[model samples]
Target chain A: MCDSCGCNITPGNRHLVAEGEPGHQAIDVLQHLLSANDHAAAHNREHFDRHGVLAYNLMSSPGAGKTALLEATLQALAGEFRIAVIEGDLETENDAERIRRHGVPAIQISTGSACHLDAHMVHHALHDLDLDAIDLLFIENVGNLVCPASFDLGQHRNLTLLSVPEGDDKPAKYPVMFRAADAVVFTKTDLLPVFDDFSIERATRYLRELASAAPVLNASVRSAQGLAAWLDWLRDDMRALRARIAGGEAVRPAVQPDGAALHAAESAA
Target chain B: MHELSVCQALVEQVVRVAREHGAGSVARVTIGVGALSGTEPALLRQAYPIACAGTPAEGSTLEINERPIRVRCALCGAETDARANRLLCGACGDWHTQLLSGDELLLEQVELAKLAEAI
Candidate 1:
């Protein structure tokens, strides 16, 4: 029997069944799966513009303290910035609930078995939020460091987080996320004294070498250490985003070709 | 993990392409999985069938070509295939080499058979 169609066939049959056809054929496809996500991301950017929201896509590993950073960020900036959050997870709404505790409007996107959040998911999440009331929108993408880097959530800035416990070699291990990031935040600095493996110097050097002049901030939400600098950078970024939008600039920065060296290095294994 | 997400996107694209080309079923879909793109081709293949369910590409075959990492050596000014485990130059053993290829996830082509032509 043919496994694909469950049709009985003799062993001497000349035609062997294939998954898609009777025989295998190679097609020279040169398209990117992210192309669909990219198109939807562009539309998402336009939608954000119409509502006057500055979105920031946050990327990090599972235990990198992304939600904690958001909680602290909302508490500190809430008086000034009308912050909202869209949390992506494979299962729970725990992160979204945590952000909501800060009194900011928050939405949780459960991607089911998928590991990353695409632009279409963000578009759907946006429809549920009151865009007019949102000033600074934060999207905490799924925890994996790899896939989220390939997706753009229509954010004005992309922030990648790495906790101290994750080690200084993260920039070397996950270069593409670091390269695409507008700013890299080193979280869980409060644990630095406890772990000898954490080296700020090594992390800084590697990040500078990979990102070439991108900003790196070490922060700990528990102690509020370095949180001020983080908030200040966000303020500056949001201000600039506002200026650009007001100037009628496009929602996103200029699109560089995917073949750029920086992108290649970061996305490279 | 991420392969599952990529697989889902792949199925959606194959369906769209098949419909546009007026094909009843997809014959083949070619995708380039760059060596440095952080995608595991084996994992993508394992997840492809599950992600393709209920789509036009349900039984379609996913052809993934493994792309080698290409890098430009900083010391020798030469471009060569890079070793995935180490970013060092293939010829000079320089760690400061700049990467050139193997970070792309490109969909190269799609083959579909016309409904009337299918045996």
Candidate 2:
């Protein structure tokens, strides 16, 4: 065990020896390695608080229509909210540009070889956008369901999207993502009939089992099916968020999005 | 897949800790990699060297302690180890279970090299 010291000490013995040595010592950290990223995320959350921005981290597999849903939601809620986006991808500013076309400011963070977007990257991207002017900030996370679940970007909520084409077993297959989700959106609902094997009831059941309190909403941008519910969720969430800020709460409460958006939609009509 | 970035973060923490303690170099870094941490130990081991290159942690030994996934079943009130990702209750065969452990990705300790003593 001791190739360097050549002493009759095991690796564990070396640890003890190192700790007892004059200058050499074994530091017992017992800390999460991602604490640095978590710290950065905390700072980002503080910034969002001062700006009254209700941030959402959108996570899903590739081609799950995250960008398309964002586009549709932006159009539907045009003048109601000041929305901005931070699009993350391994390559390309294409998603960011698409968001910009909807008249919302967006910043694309291209994480060269990184599969997930860390808090450090979001911290930099926050500086690039005018946070104070944004009512809502959408962090479209790397279009990835796995690695993104582990990294906290300090968003007010985490929403995991599962499209009908991706199958109903996604919640079970990728439990971490579902468990980490504040809410799960079933996107591309219009394609449900086409994909006979994809069951909304089954998906919702799994989502309920994993993320007990998280809402499982269905939306199809193509048919504008659940877009209203999606947009209302945003508006009502922002309203409650504004209320919290007005009341001097630094952080959002554990209040789930319980159809407040739907109530707002009804009142507007 | 993101083990490279995870290792990068690990290196940053190690370097910071090393500097704080006024250590010259890192001898060994011990960490816990849980079964459900979504990181591959092999990938992390491979990336550790690359992440450490050009830093004080260069050539430092990265010792990973694999932690098993532990779950607490609600039905049978039993705590059991969950092999793979089944997450079912071992005692009652129920899926109504909550995770108690195995998502941890922690840096347990760091062995710092001492400065050379005067003859």
Report, for every candidate in turn, its global Cα lDDT versus the true structure: 0.76, 0.79
Q: Which runs in model 1 stand beyond 4 Å of their true positions?
A: A1-29, A208-212, A246-269, B52-60, B71-100, B115-119
- Listed per model in order, the count of residue pairs whose N, CA or C atoms clash below 3 Å is 15, 0
Q: Which stretches of candidate 2 lie over 4 Å from their true place?
A: A1-24, A208-212, A239-269, B73-77, B83-97, B115-119
Per-residue lDDT for A1-269 in model 2, tens only? 44566476654445555566565568888767677776677678889987778898899999999999999988887897889999999999899899999889999999997888988999999889898788888899987778887777778788889999999989878876777787789999999889999998988776655524577788999999988888777677678777877887654323211122222233357
True contacts kept of 1: 0.35
Candidate DockQ scores, in order: 0.37, 0.44
RMSD of each: 7.2, 7.4
DockQ of 1: 0.37
Second chain of candidate 1: TM-score?
0.88
Q: Estimate each model's TM-score.
A: 0.79, 0.84
lDDT at A197, model 2: 100
Instruction: Find the 10 residues in a row with the least total lDDT in model 2 chain B.
Output: B110-119
lDDT of 1 by residue, B1-119 (tens): 67877788788877877777667777667777775676789999999889988776778777776777887877788887855545566787666677677777877767675544554
